[model samples]
Target: MVDILMATYNGEKYISEQLESIIGQDFKDWKLFIRDDGSKDNTIHIIDNYMKKFPDKIELIDNYNRNLGVKLNFGELMKRSKNQYCMFSDQDDVWLPNKISITLNKMKELEKVYDNKKPMLVHTDLKVVNQDLKLLNKSFFKYANIDPKRNTLNKLLVKNTVTGCTMMINSKLRKVISEIPKECVMHDHWIALVASICGGIGFIDIPTILYRQHGNNQVGANSNSLLKKLIKHAKDFRYRFYTEQAEILYRSYSNFLNSKDSRIVKEFIQLRRYNCIKKRYVIMKNNYFTNVMLNRIQMFLCC
Candidate 1:
């Protein structure tokens, strides 16, 4: 059985569609753990309505507590789950009918091939969608062809190459995530980083979910324009460096004990992160350095 962990706050407009999508999954042996992170709107009301209709399929937990961010929300859910398998859920995204079945099959395949002691985390590519659920010609499955054994810090440095909403991680990985440094970025990235270190990640090229992008996006919209990315990089430094992303990656490099090729790539990333923290003037002075700094800042904040 699968437990779908979702955190919602003022997501009334889209929560129902997402909930319906999960409810309609071809894989029926799953439950939805709905937790509202202090929603000011009818997000709770809408969920309450749905829970009334399908009490067996959904469980609502909305005891208003402190406004814990996404990382803590996820960590809290992991602590509460007793299932052997758990999947990350976003408040506004709709999963395809076979999402659970496909990911579960992949995890079982990995389990057969690798040591049982190896912590398992499997993720699939996702199709991007708008608030209205219109499909966009993009995916989070770019790393589908990557060799799990060859996964390295350097590959992770060039790009995150991981999508959180589409991930399914085993409960055994819970301890590793619980112990991750709080400064590490989003839960998805943190999980990906930990997976890279402990066992390895299994990737699926199939698009399993409609990853919705909305106005109050915690990770913002997924746009493909290079010019737009360049512009946003300069504007969102706080979203980048101060977040868990920078620290998690830094820790990954610091803890990496693998191939020299990957280690060297991570070293550059770590050095660059270190330089930025020290407020390296060399990066600020050079035009190209400024661009790199801006890009780093953007990634740190968004991840």
Candidate 2:
């Protein structure tokens, strides 16, 4: 059996659709646990109405008025789930009927392959959507090369490739993730980081969920237009520079390494020095930049 953990905060507009998607799933052995983080709208009303309709399948927990950010809310959900396998759900995303079954099967396969080792988390590709549930594009995870090894602290430092809405973490992972340092990044990123540390991380390349992108989206969805891309870059730069949030994530990972093994901590310290701001300048100083610029100019002039 699986427990679906969903956190909500004033998501009345799309909650019903997302709930319907889950309720319509072909998999029968699952329960949906929704924790409302003090929504000032009819979101809680909608959830309560659904729970009354399907008392056995759906349950709602009133989280009062605590504005626990996304990471904390998700952490709370994980801490409360009472199942062997837990899947994270966003308030507005619509999952495919096979989403749970496919992810659960993959986790089962990985368990068999890894043998005595603990199971790692499994996440699938997502189909990006708009507020009205119109499909924009699929999140093709081809841009970054995913390392298959268990220890991927080095690889994860480059980017967070896993999307939370499509994530299904094992119970073992859920038990230990709460111990992650408070300075860590988003929950999904932290999950990926820990999964890389504990056991093998698996990915389902096909899209199994509709990752809705709305106006109130905390983290902007991936964009393709040049202007939107630049705007997103600017926003990220502002966040990273002003809050130094990425550094918090780095240090938490560093702490995790220190607790795991001293050698990894030392290596992480060295990498922080080499791969920090100075590393970008050092790479640009090499002849690679000159050759790239010359090639770009030649191509542009010919065009």
Candidate 3:
């Protein structure tokens, strides 16, 4: 059985469609816990209607408590999950009927290998769609040029591959997520790094949800332009931010990591503080860096 945590904020436009899709999931044993983050819209009203329609299937929380934002709202719900597995849900995306079934099956397969003692996380790619629910791409990984092979600790330190809506994590890791530090970024990114260090990290190449890009999203995918990334690299201070995340992860989760991973993390932290020459030397000596070409260049320059 699974507990689905949804963080809602002014999602009135697409809330019902997403709710309906969840209602159609082949796996019916799931319990949905929704926290509306201060929506000055009909989103809460719609959620209430759905709760009324499926009293046994849904539990609503943070009714009028606005301004919690996505991170804290989801964090509150994650802590209360009493299920073997927990999943993250966006109020907008439409899940295919088999989404829960397939994700749960893959989680089970990973559990078979990693066992229950280790934290387990399994996420799938998504079908990118426009506001009208028209397909923009068949495979998000290909369309975005994503390569999952680089989902390692050092790589994940800078980039997040585990999209929350498509992710299902075991209870053990859910507990860790509930305790994530305030300085941490998204729950998915923190949870992914935790799983990479302490347990099983699995991926499903096929998409399980329709990822909507409605242009009014609270947190949508980054702009898909090399030029924009270059611009953000300067304007957003992303290099420093990524370096901060790497430091926070090392400081917070060092105990969960093995000796080698801890060393890699420590080396990366040092590399961030290193000058370009020293950074390159450390990377050359320890190879404690990402594998992707773009990310490698970014890391090299940032370091």
Candidate 4:
């Protein structure tokens, strides 16, 4: 009933554990579409062995062994995805047995309300864990302060609370994200923005995966203290890239945005194109800043 798009890259150390986790899922109506991102290690071997064991449920994408970074690989996965719903998985994280069932349950419930026509996204919180799988935090949302109320089009311009590994996106969102412009940012961020603009986001407060935090993690969580996060968000250099990337998303999908969202994005884009006082005025007059005050000030400093 669901297609799991898993991207692997040199994950020999924990591939078996991760695959076992997936195989142990309480929800069995799922297929694993593995895409190896040029793993120099035995990652592919491990996945192949698993595919051999579960040929009916798991298989590798053909001629896709080239290294395309996680974002584009996932975008390609979306394009090739075949199912009513799709789920993303990391090569190393150990998912809870209930991960697929819980996410799919929420996805189905949300689609029912949206009549399955709108782009709906369902994501759960995660239990941050260490390399050895020791539990760190129970809820990633609480540790990261990921509030669903702030997941609007404007707020998504600054922050992304929707972690891909814990998300199950419907076919509508899968198709929408597959066609997102190349200039857009990461797949998860682009998906969140698309969900906000096209349909809606459904968040599960429960942790669905053991989000590992190994030293070699490509993109790990920021489990810093709240004060540290605020100070970090208040830095001009920090927001420059995010602001620029947000501009790319706006520039690419402006027409897809609603009138209000479109105007805000248009104004922000036009505002940033200017120099001196006009830029500052635009920043002040606009409501596109992040939900936090310090972050807004930091973005202002960026301007």
Candidate 5:
């Protein structure tokens, strides 16, 4: 059975439509597990109403109601998952009917090739939509210039292409993320890094969900122009956090990482100590560059 882990906070506006989409899925063998992070709005009340209607298929994990933020909230839900396959859900996005079936099928194929004990992740593209559910972009990956195929350990450390809402993980991958680090850029990025290092990651080119973008979105698609994106990246780049995240990865999974992987993580962490030119050189030498040219240039200049 698949366990759908959804973390909600102030999602009253679109939560019902999201729930309806999940309930109408063609794949029936799944249970929805929701945890609210102390929302001030009527989000919890709406969830309670849904719980009354589909008590068998949906559950509200009410034991913890404190606010742990999004990353920790999802981390707690991951810890409570007790199924073979697990998928992350956003309270605002509408999943396509075949999302579970397609993702699970790809996950099963990955399991057949790699042992069941090996960690694996399967993610798909998404359709970018406005708050009103109008299609803003046909493909999220194209909209963001993300190449989901570039999912190696070194590559993912620089840029994460996997979106949590569109991804499914095996129990092994779930175990790999036993504790979410405070240094993690995001839960999905951390999970992708673990899967890339520990086992494998697969991707489906098809859009699986309507990724809604709105004012309240914690993180949404960036449809800015090239110049605007470059200026924004230059202004907001936090080089220290990336180094800290690498250090955490090296410290946490040193035993599982091979010598090459260990060296890559070490080099990435050490980039902060080098001169700007040397930093750019090391990034280029190690091929730690994203697919987007502007972002890669920014990384070279900022790091």
Candidate 6:
């Protein structure tokens, strides 16, 4: 059975539709586990009503007295998962009818190739839509210029191509990421990094989710021009931010990492102390760059 984990906050507006879509999935052997991050809105009331209707299929985690933010909220839910496969769900995005069947089929294919004991992750593309469910972009990967095939540890460390709501993980990966660190930029990025270093990552080119974009989205797709994105990254880039996360990865899984991965992680953490020219050279020599050229240039200039 698959355990679908969802983290909710003040998402009363679109959550009902999202839950309805999940309930209408073609795949039937799954239970939805939801945890509220102290929503003051009618989100909890809606969830409680759903619970009364689908007691066996939907469950509300009882430890909602305090707020744990988004990352920790999903982290706690993942730790409580006891199924063979787990998929992260947003409180707002609508999953297509075949999402579970397709993702689970890919997961099974990956397990056959890599063996079930190996940590594995399967993620797909998404369709970007406006708050009114109108099509904003047909493909989120293309709309955002994200290359999902860049699943290497070095590339993922610089930028995350995997979207949490489009991802599914096997039991091995769920156990490997038993706890998410506070230094993690996002839960999905951290999980992708661990999978890249430890085992394999599978990608489906098809879009399985209607990725909703709204004013309240925590992190939505960016349809900005190349120049605009360059300026934004230049203004927001923090070398220390990336290094701190790498440091935590090294600290947490140094023993599990292979020699080359260990070296890459160490160099990533140490590059912060290097001179500007040397830092850029190290990034180039080690191939520690993202798939996007503008973002790579921004990293070269800012780091």
Instruction: Give the candidate number with the greatest lDDT.
Output: 6
Per-residue accuracy of model 4 over 13-39 as CA lDDT, tens digit each: 987998999999999999889888888
Query: What is candidate 5's lDDT per residue for 1-303, written digit by digit as tens?
Result: 999999999999999999999999999999999999989999999999999999998998964558888888898899879889899999999999999999999999889887676899999999999899999888988877788988998888888889999989988888887978767999999999988888899999999999999885624336457677777766655667777888898899899899998888999899889999888888887888667586577865584
Across residues 1-303, which tens digit of lDDT does each residue of candidate 6 receive?
999999999999999999999999999999999999989999999999999999999999976456888888999899779999999999999999999999999999989886677899999999999898899888898887688998899888888889999999999988988998878999999999999987789999999999998886624336457677677766655667888999999998898888898888998898889999888877877787675576577766684
Worst-scoring 10-residue span by lDDT in model 4: 234-243
Model 5 spans > 4 angstroms off = 63-65, 216-225
Badly placed stretches (over 4 Å) of model 2 are 140-151, 179-181, 218-303
Please provide, for model 3 over 213-294, each residue's C-alpha lDDT reduced to its tens digit, 9 standing for 90 to 100: 8776423337888767655543532545666667888877777878888887787676557788887676666544443455
Residue 21 alpha-carbon offset, candidate 4, angstroms: 0.8
Off by over 4 Å in 3: 63-65, 216-237, 283-291, 299-303
| Global lDDT of each candidate | 0.68, 0.67, 0.79, 0.78, 0.87, 0.88
Give the TM-score (vs. native) of candidate 6: 0.96
Query: Model 5 misses residue 112 by how many Å?
Result: 1.0
Listed in order, each prediction's TM-score against the native is 0.75, 0.76, 0.90, 0.89, 0.95, 0.96
Number of the candidate with higher TM-score, 1 or 6:
6
Residue 125 lDDT in candidate 3: 91
Q: With candidate 4 superimposed using the best TM-score fit, by how many Å does residue 77's alpha carbon deviate from the native?
A: 1.2
Question: How many residue pairs clash (N, CA or C atoms closer than 3 angstroms) in each of the candidate models, in the order given?
Answer: 6, 0, 1, 0, 0, 0
Residue 97 in candidate 1 has what lDDT? Answer: 93
